[model samples]
Every structure is written in C-alpha cells, then in structure tokens.
Target: MTNAADARQTKPDWSAVRLHVVTGKGGTGKTTVAGALALALAAGGERPGARRVLLVEVEGRQGLAQLFEAAPLPYEERRVAVTPDGGEVWALAIDAEQALLEYLDMFYKLGPAARVLRRFGAIDFATTIAPGIRDVLLTGKTCEVVRRRAESGQGPGHGHDRVFDYDAVVMDAPPTGRITRFLNVNSEVSGLARVGPIRNQADAVMRVLTSAQTAVHFVTLLEEMPVQETLDGFADLRAAGLPAGGVIVNQARPIVLPEDRLKKAAQPGGLDQAELEAGLAPVGLADPEVVTALAALAAEHAQRVLLEAEQREALAATEAPMYELPLLGDGVDRVGLDLLARELRRQGAA
Candidate 1:
C-alpha cells in the first residue's frame, strides 16, 4: 500500500491500453475521473493523434454532458470535439435497446426480431427491472465497442483476426455494487450458449477484458464508506478473475499547513496577541469573541486537513496503484476539466 504522497509520485502508463473502464461507489466522482482520463488521452499531443478515443456512458446519466459542458449525447456516437493533436473525440450514451438491436442485426441478422423481443417483454423486462441482466447487457455493449470490427470489403474476419479500429474506449461503467457482475457476464452467457454465436462473442469479450491491453480503474473519494466499498470491490473483481487495474482517490485536499503549525494554532492563546490586534483593527472588529471565532474557523480547517490525511491512509491500505485528483473548490466546468486533463498528463495517466 502506497501512501498518498507515494501514490502521487508513481505514474500510470496509459499508452499500453485499449480500454479503460472507470467505476466506483456512487457519488464518488467516477464520472469526473472518466471524463478527465478521456480528455487526457485526447490531449496527448506527442502521441499518435489521440488514437480515436470513444467516451461511453452506460447509465444515461448525462455525466459526459456535464463534464464536457455540451448537450447530453443521444443513443448513437457523436463527434464531440477535436483533441489538441487534431484527433477526434467521440461520445455516446449507450442505450440498451439500441445496443440490443445492433447486436441482433450484426450476429443473428434478426430483422424485426428486436422489436418482437421488446414487445414480448423479453428485452424490456430483462433490461429495465432485472438485476444482473441489465448489467450483463450494458457490459456486453461496452465489450462490443472494444471488439467492433472494421469493414474488410469481403466480410468480417474470424474472432481474433478482426483488429480493433478504435485506439481506446473509456467506459463510465455501473456503480460499485453492480460492476463486478457487469464485468463477469461471459460466465453467464457461456451457460446459455454452449455452442453458438453468443458463446463465441462472449469468449471474445472475455479475452479482451482479461488481457493486459484492457484496464479497469476505480474512482473513489477519501471518505469512509467509499473507501470500504472500493476495497470490497477490488476483492470482488480479483476473485472473479477480472483485472484490477488501479484506484483513483478523488477530491483530495492539499495539506498546506504543517503539523507543528497546526498544533500551535490549536493551542489556546497560541496566536500572537500583537499581530491579532493589528489584523483585526483594520476591520473594526474589536470584540475578543469575534477574534476567537475567526481563530476557531482556522482550527476547524486544520482538523479537516487531519481527517483528510487519515482518509488517505485508509485508502492506501488497499494496495492498488492509486492516483489523487484534487478537490475543485470552484465547481466543475470546461475550464476545470482542462485543468484535470493537464494534471492527468503530468501524472503520466495520458
């Protein structure tokens, strides 16, 4: 387990990857990290033209829109923007219905069968209310993107012969509780398709996921519940034979004040009396109670800093390669996203 300081020092090699799946406990800023990573890869000016990056969201959460400051993406892929090196960045919100249709059309050539499945409650009930099925479908769709084949003029090649056209795909996958099952759907499909097309497809997807070329990163905050969940999630992924890529601690606070300075501030009457009087005199705040209140605020900030340190330590114990993204005091927007992109590059995540 590397401490926060050490974790920050270590750099991630993003060049050796084709897919980066970002997930964590809900509200842990998983979406933010996913967006930042996509931007970072796109902004890799020295690399070979950003490598046709695709940012995918499965839950229709509009996170990409919020991060990019653009309109929410529809079911299909849309060219969002160009990267610094003129590489195209495409964004998509995965619609289970559409993915299902595409899946049927590509493999089964099942014309109108997709509509029949929806009308007969097979697709609707299975994807909407079903627990594990929705995860399987979403995960299947993402895997499909990673496995999509380019046109060969004659016909699609065999499973491994088809080369992935997209350089990288960033998936803002499901939350912590469901992500394990989401990534492990090959086992489920294997049971259903013993010797058929689905079986082959499942095997291909599993191959890609388990390969070193693909990575899954979990984004978390330095908080108690998220930390615990991240630990558990890591264990689940490893147990299921899925790759445990790395951990990212989001919204980390800067330890601006040293411990000795913080302790002195906590001490009663530790502040310089003359300096306090001089600083408060200009504001016409002569009351000792007001000065005490101001001092208390500083003390509170110091305590929060200590709490942040403790949280970082707890997160470090998970032993995964960790990255810390600073807390943005100002709200997230395009400018904030640009800052995050630069930070990711500096940390070698790009």
Candidate 2:
C-alpha cells in the first residue's frame, strides 16, 4: 500500500475546493465538462478513498440529464451515475419556480399558500418586477446544498453512504456572457432587500462564492472569440473577487503531420499539387483531381494547426492551470465522458 507521503504528493490541484462552477461560451461544452469533472472527482480512489459529488444544473435547460442520457430531472437530487470506485454522482436540475416555493417554505412556512402564490402570477411578478429575487432563490438553494452535512455523521470518502454529504458540488452555470451577473447575486438583489432573508441569502451565497472553497472554471475552444471570452471571464471573476479556476480547452484536435510537411502546406498559396501527387504515387491515387482534393485537405489542416498554436499563446496570458480535452471522433457518449474524466484525473483536475 502507498504511504502518506505518496498520498499528499498525489493531491489534486483543487483539493481545497468544494464548489466548482463551470461556464463557457455556448458550444464550448460547459455542461459536458462539469459532468466529466464530477466523474473524475468521485472516482480515482480505492474503497475507503472514494468520494461522492453532486452535479447541479441551474439554467433550467435540463441539459445535464441530456448530457448523461437520462430522463428529465426534477428539482430533487437523484443518483444519475455511479463511479468506478463505487462513489455516486447525483444530479439535480434546479427550477426557479420550484426554488422559489422552497424558499418560501423555508422562511415563511408558506405550506399550500406557495402554490396559491404561483397560481395568481406571483411567480411572474417576482421574476419580472423583482428579477433579483429569482437569483437570490436559485443561489440560496445551491448554497444550501453546498453547506449540507451528512445525517449519519460520516464525512465524505469514508466507505459508507453519505445521506446528505457531498465532497464537492459542480454547477453547469450560464454562458460566459451572463455568468458574471448570474453569480454576483448580492449586487443584483441589494436594492430588492437590504436586511431581510433575501439579502441574507444573497450574502451567504457571496460568502461561499468569494471564498477559497469555491472556484469558477471557464471552458473554451481554441478559437478566437471563445479564447477572448475566456480571458474576459477571468478578468470579470477577478473584479468580482470570486475565485477563478482552470481554463479548460475543449475539443482540441491533434497535429498529425510532421513539422516539415505542415510548414510546407501552411503557406498562403496552398500546397504544391505536383509534389502531393508524387507522395500519393505508391497507392496509384495520383490523379490531378485527387491531388487537388488532398492538397485542399492538407491546407485546411495546416491552417487549423497554425491558428490553434496562436490561440494557445493567447491563453498563456491567463496564468491559470490549463487542461485540454481531445475532440471525440464519434461524438460524446458515456465512453467519451469516461475518457475525459481520465484525462482530468491525469491532469490533476480531480
């Protein structure tokens, strides 16, 4: 068995982090990354070292369920997937309306009157006239989950079922464009409630948000706009005093050709067709049309490689730990998620 020194050396980069908030430009695979992170965190351990983590989706898109190929999830947490180490990854899709009802019940004992409020357009009124309350309710519920303790008095990673304890919580948050405002709920609701439960809840959420226990990671592709947005999002996090996590570059394509050929094909005038035809001569596939097609493909690959290198340089300025996930040839599935989780573990993102 490994000793204590090896265990300490193997600790993850985010070992102190309990709340992981993932956001990205749309199509950057934010939800996918969040799910993979949960899997990575929960597994990667032997019997007594296993962990249980919760993956929450707050956008009401039910996209988390779709990512896992499960049916639509209610507001309640349920076991969506079990990790290789027998740990659990529970999922919850938080709905604004349901969260509002729960908030009412928690503070005011609304009982059946909560539904009455919903029936008479109170939900709409709160959402429209006092939109900030919506944010307060949603974030408050998430904080509640993050702070919950186990009923059995067993902390996480103890080889027993943790009824309410989770080692970490991963949220698939909004797109980068709105993530700042979405997370800074205290400012959003300051005018709505200065000293009431709403303000208190908002304050509590912010406390967790600005603490070392929380980290907001940005997912991005190696494209211009996504990379720029990732940079901007990191700046926003710094301004908000929220903890920023890693920059996870997703759907990264590999550079297949050798350096010499890649440089030759990356020229502005495109590839040398006659030279490419000779390269294909051994296969009896050196026709002019085939040569032209091959040259075009090579040119595209070269351009992509060169652009990706430029973006990588841009991402370097962020100074955050970087993690890259490969583009799955067959698209993302359970197996794809497993592969990504392994990569995350190998990269110390777990």
lDDT of each: 0.74, 0.84
Q: Per-residue lDDT tens digits of candidate 2, residues 138-214?
A: 77778888889776644343446654488889999989988888889988987778998888889999998888889
Error of 1 at 52 (Å): 2.3
The numbered model that scores best in TM-score is 2
Per-candidate TM-scores read: 0.84, 0.91
Q: Which ten residues in a row have the lowest lDDT in candidate 2?
A: 1-10
**Which pairs clash inside model 2?**
none
Model 1 CA deviation exceeding 4 Å by range:
1-11, 45-50, 119-121, 128-133, 149-163, 187-195, 265-287
Clashes of 2: 0
CA lDDT for candidate 1: 0.74
lDDT of 2: 0.84
